[model samples]
Target: MTRTRFAPSPNGPLHLGHAYAAIVAHDLARARGGTFALRIEDIDGERSRPEYVAEFFADLAWLGLQWDGDPVFQSARLGSYVHPGERLKAMGLLYPCRCTRAEIAAAATLFGPDGPIYPGTCKHKQVDPEGAAWRLDVAAAVALSGPLEWVDEIAGSQRAMPEVFGDVVLLRKDLPASYHLAATLDDAADGVTLVTRGLDLFASSHVHRLLQALLDLPVPTWHHHALLVEPDGRKLAKRRGSPSLGDRRRGGEDGPALAAALRDGRLPAGISLSRSLHTGA
Candidate 1:
């Protein structure tokens, strides 16, 4: 059975971009007689809120989207997030890095997908595990995987090139898993068959494909739809204070109508979809 999930972090309200993503996932699953699952990526430490969790349910319902089964919470699966990193560490594919962002920026010379591609400053160093993050050795990982590929419904087939992100984080110093590790595991665990998300996250699929190969998880086809963005091409984001679904609902806008209009390519004035591939993933 085809399964898709809308996983949102409870850091803030659901913006239009989020609405677009959720609607796409929900509609695709319903149209195919598949399952549309909801997942709360609430493992953002203290930045995640309980109220935002409740709000996601309300906002999704108002938008005429119904999920299958109970929502999955990343917080509840904390233990499960650790084993992957541990296995990688044991396999000598992960190393503890104590470098801060400022430290990395000072030493970095090359730029990659996530920016300044970690210069491997800490790759050979033996940093204390207490205050360090575990980074994946992408070169070694790709060598082990021996060429990986994944399919995208919109962007077509892709070659897994996680090296662009350099030594990406597998485990965070504070969290059991970084976004890369957690998201890859979460989708697999939810049995998501089609990962429908905005194009802003398009690059992330490469790393995810590599992880799936390394851990021997099921690979799923992805659908990276266009992102709803401002006229200037800035993607609608919670951090950007984009008008939220809850505010729209509170303002007496017809939720179902809004979704319908969005489906019909009717966006609010001056809003457009970004077609850029250089977005921050």
Candidate 2:
């Protein structure tokens, strides 16, 4: 079956961009006579809120998106990340790094698609901190996987170059798993065949492809859509004060109608699609 998911973080209410992404995934599944799944990415211990999670269900329901089965909560799957993490560790492709963000910024001489790439300061360090993050030795990982490539419906064929982002953290210092580790494992476990999301995450797919190879997981195709932006071309973000869909719902707007508008490219005033933020890896 062609399965796709709309995984959203429960850190804030759904905004217009999120609505667009969800509708796209839902409609794609519907078009293919497949399944549409919802996954709650609530692993951010400090920021995730129960109230926001409830709002997510209500908003998706209001949008008329019917997901298959129950939603998968990342918080409930902490232990599932252990084996893959341990597999990497066992292969000696994972290392503990105690470097702080400030220290990395000070040492980073080259920047990749995701900002300043780590300089591998602790790749060979003998000392390990109590709560150090576990980073994937990207060069070693890629060499083990040999040459890899993934296909994107929109971006065409992409060569997987995990080294672009340097050594990415597989386990965070404060959490059991990082986004790269948790998301990749969850997608494979759920049997997702088509992964769809915003173009902003296109670069992160490169890292994910490598993780799939290392963990011996089933590979999935990707479709990274353009981002919805404000009139000034700024991408909609909760931190940037982008208006939430809840507010619009409370204002008496019809959810299905709004979804149709987005599908038909009939965006409301002050909203536009932007493709200016493409990233490479």
Prediction 2 global C-alpha lDDT: 0.90
Give a tens-digit lDDT track for model 1, residues 90-134: 888999899999999989999976778899988888778887888
Minimum summed lDDT over a 10-residue window in model 2 is located at 272-281
- At residue 168, give the lDDT of candidate 1: 93
Clash tally, candidates in order: 0, 0
lDDT scores of the candidates, listed in order? 0.89, 0.90
The stretch of ten residues in a row with the least summed lDDT in candidate 1 is 272-281
Identify the leading candidate in terms of lDDT.
2
Cα lDDT tens digits, model 2, 191-246, are 99999999889899999999999999999999888899987888899998888988
